[model samples]
Target: MQIQKINLGAEPSGIGGDSARTSNGKVNTNFDAVVAEFADVRASIPSVTSDLGQSTTIAISQKLFTDTLMSQFNDIGVQGALGFGTGITNKLPTGMSQMQGTAIKGHENWGNYQYSDGSVMVYVPRFYYRWGHVNSPNYAKYGVNALDVKSIYDFVDVVAANAAGYALHRAFYDDGQIKDGFFVDKYQCSNNAGKASSIKNGIPLSSSSANAPFSGLTGAPANTLAGAIDAAKTRGSAFFATTIFIQRALSLLSMAHAQAATSSAACAWYDATGVNNFPKGNNNNALRDVNDTAVLYEGTGYLTAGKTGSAQPFAKTTHNGQYSGVADLNGNMWEVALGLTQTAGSFYVLRTSAKASALTSGATLATDAWGTAAMTASYDSLGASYGELTGVVRNFAIGSTTNQVFSTANSGLAWSASCAGIPQLGGAGGTNAYGNDRFYDNRIEHLCPIVGGNWSYGAYAGVWAVHCYFSRTNGDHHFGVRAALYSV
Candidate 1:
């Protein structure tokens, strides 16, 4: 690893002057070079010697040496050419606007949510972006089409330290710039300001040595689940026994976190399925206590952009399930999150606890990030005609015939107060996958009101299975149902 190589293709340093009075001025330039990012266990631990109470200083210094050594050769590039130099800034990496200045790209680090109802929710990060370089301008602008088409996957294991977390990872980190940039690569920090910025580059983000690298969001992203185990085993003296205990510990924690996790707060994951030849389903606990890697794994701790709510809605709702920040709820079931709030009418109830106190809110109503509808609304109101007597769903029809029809347009179909019996399409619904299509769910909570009722939903073949939720009415009465924003 070169120590201060700049894009000039050679090491950039001062040439010793001929005159006895050499220059004594300091300049601020990126010391672009290879770096070893790791931590000193001994420095942090009290005793790690044979005496178990020996010199803390020696132990720390030793661990520090190892950390530095491993990071030097730690980066094992599996996919493309890997090198360090001032050229990093020559092509600044892009991430979520909030993750600015981070060397590592996000999304390549986490997974999304999957539910008991065969539903899944995800927030696609701005993983695909073009960098129109703006380094105070006399600078150059770069895009993916220009430099080495590298990837963060090449270093996932090194970053997370746990290949297990790589399992079930689903994400698409692409650099859309076709003409001027480089493919996604890990962000390598350049020097910092004022002090020795050189060491800044070596400060990788993850806190684990391996295995449990991810953000500490609740539920799936909890740092302690896989991470705590990694720490206990890798950092402890009894590697074997400690690992077993950690596994048991993680199970308890997962269930707890899972228990508390609401749909809106589910942790997201990266799509590790084949894009990088990663295994299909990551083993839940493969390296429970194994930290054989010679160096510390330094990468982002969390992979998600906005999964702060790890606790269950039971814990968040101010009204005790009456009202909350759920996404798949009725319009009245409102709260706020950057993503979206959904009224539960459109969402299909799919668990033993479909009602309040049973199921928590679904994944946060996420607008599409991959398709053209990312900015569309995340929820729709299941109101009036599709009324609720008590929390149960009821249907109301207005057409002369029993057959109910729906259009892509927000046609007010069943929303009549005085039994005109028309159904309506919500304007706030997320756009469907197929242009404005409708999805028919045989799993209607129940049919109500008018004599024998009929509900019909139609959309282009592409529209029915769309992302939006639909509510149906059989008769005039409203149905009673627990609602919240939902994601499938």
Candidate 2:
């Protein structure tokens, strides 16, 4: 047990060659130069753990001097834990790659947009149908399980008048397999289902022969409105099936604006009594299923013949409530858009051609003779103009001033605050009391555009309702077509 050599430096240990201080000189605590600098930091700990696990090149220059001292002490390092680093042996400084090209392309919902006149626009949001159709298999049993929808189902072959243009041309031209293989027209509404060889009564005329004589000269991607805007431009690029602007049909009626308070006053009709906006025997516009089924459809009204009343299914009609993402819109039936018109004293518009060169200088762009010299590209009713309104108002009257109407007058076509001057809106089962009012009048030529509102007008089937009094060659059962796309 021989341990004794506490010298504490500055010298005096074996006593007297230097200073170790004491004898009132008082100076200690250098425990042998802190035990020889803790034995030289425990012999440089395995060479600083093998230079931080072989990051060598002297651990990348001591990790770039410990990331510049952790970015000037605590700004955190490794560029916030590995984010930037590419090419030129990366140590990243600016390279979001391009030209110095190290491969750095990033964008998530990338649809592409640039136009400020620099022109580039591409947008393909899942091929935008805005949330209209797409569920199919004839929607299980003709869809609408919004939960249960009171059981009973047949839906009178799914509410005719072109079954919302045959379920929006079978969710994108006969069961959209990417718009049925890059589109070659597959709209089918009556070529087989209710067969007559093609009895033109559900008239949207695509003609597989049989009585085909509505003569907008026969062509049927889904039958007119220029074959549902050429099958909604095959799901992209300015496609249209009648949303002829009015602020793009009130941005699709503020996406079913809160079912205008309980589906706009309800009405599958049955003497909807007192009618203070037609609430009487309400069904909140049919089709339920929040927990199980049956939200209101006590029957007696698909015009009675076998009663298909409560309606609401297909895509499960979701105004601004519940099913939210755009569906039946307001009641089901009646959607007809394609350019918009009102004629006389000014309101005409035939658009496209980049919306008539972007309007405003007495607004031009019409031509192609602007209809009537046998207008081509589908639709002719013997041509007076079917590119969108020419004339021939005959029985439902209101024609003869030369045509092209629907106004709210901001002076020569502007209307939209739910459409001013005329083209009235707001789903009205009966009296959702102007559920959001407006439905203009003062007819002009074959009017056209008759959006949302049918199932017997329970509170006026809304989504900005408008029935410009028939005539784009009129096809009833209630009339339908919805599927739009846009680019540029």
Candidate 3:
């Protein structure tokens, strides 16, 4: 017996066939057709044989019937049974290729890829988020209401749309097809020989060296940010650690902590008394992981003396407390974020040309002086437009009466939230809830943004920390660099 085809015609409209019914026509004919199709299906079942048990005969008949029915359907039916085609292909973005490496245990979302210079990169897929208070008290005080979660693309599109015609916007949206996510250095960028690398035991490159690696002024090896970008641009994709990229990285890491909480309760990461999900790097004076109580340096003397990227204690310094998340985002060293500048008490995202000038200007914001706006307007605009994306207000000033401070008692010091949407400035309240990550800014000087607190910051270093006190040309030993790749 063979399975017969049943023609249902044009879906909803033809599902019931004719509305008008006559005793010998329309509905009767439709019923007859359906009954005939059922009869064929019933006839397809094989009879139970004496040699074969009833269960075995029924199983065989079921398989035959299923095979015959499935054969009449489309490829989707076969693919569904085989668990094959998903219609979504996993393609490596430009400037990156798949690498065969030991899998990071328990982290299925993370994978290692390679750049042209053979430096390793970790791929982060895109995600969505919504705003909710960490605790009921925070909700009552801040009056933050829950919002609908949206994808990273939704946020990027808004930024691109709001800041159209700016290089900052283009650098973020036009650089690559980031809708699928992007690549970031597996570890803080290290100086290997004369090139930038992301590997274990290599010395992290300083921002001073990163500005002019071959200047001959600094004795450090050549590992400029430009070189890192060029090395990752084997396929001509934009590759650099821009503010937007760093913000996205922070967002991805914060997602785990943020989504773990109920709509009305505090998130695990945001709970003042809860376990800190963000990793503690070499932020204390002892050069140890404060969270894990592990020493980061062994018999240390100075930079690269006994300390290097992904060192034993530093292994716990990743964004996710594992090798999978971006490493050293909490401390160890401050990483430079390009394309953002604070000039004369205001903030402005630089143009592509201005970004280079920022690296060269030593005394002033002159060369990078195209866009400057008042903090009041800029802060309000940023907070109103994209603040919710991060689940926190941008450039929030900690007040004496406000419980937003790390300690409910301390006050008077103003602090800003990091891209991940957490405030870490030190105040009368001791350190802010997240980590003692501090934000430093000066109204009288032109400064560039350096993120993640440095070693010796003790109780004042975190992923949400940002320091705007250093000029683009003023790089310190504690200033380091991280690389990113935008792929299509």
lDDT of 3 by residue, 1-488 (tens): 23323344477776644332232243334444544644434544443333333332354356444543322211111100111100011566655665543132223123557766667776554433223335422244333322122333344554452232111112223222333545667666655544556765556655454222322222332243223233322222355544533543453344333323332112212333334544556766666756655546542355422244544644355554444445667667677665544544444443322232123222322432222432222221222122212322233322123333321111111112222232334222223334544445443234456777676766667776666566544546676667666445
- Cα RMSD to native, each candidate? 24.6, 26.0, 15.6
Error of 1 at 191 (Å): 48
Error of 1 at 331 (Å): 27
Candidate 2, position 164, lDDT: 32
Identify the candidate with maximal lDDT: 3
lDDT of 1: 0.18
Candidate ordering by TM-score (highest first)? 3, 2, 1
Highest TM-score, which number?
3
Q: Model 3 off-target regions past 4 Å?
A: 1-95, 101-109, 133-178, 208-237, 244-248, 255-275, 295-308, 313-315, 350-433
**What tens digits encode model 1's per-residue C-alpha lDDT throughout 173-263?**
0111111211111111111121101111122112222422222212222221122212212211111111111111111112122222233
TM of each candidate vs. truth = 0.18, 0.23, 0.55
- The CA lDDT at 475 in model 2 is 54
How does residue 310 of candidate 1 score in lDDT?
Answer: 20
Better candidate by lDDT, 1 or 2: 2
- Of 1 and 3, which scores higher on TM-score? 3
Model 3: number of clashes? 6
Question: What TM-score does candidate 2 get on C-alpha atoms?
Answer: 0.23
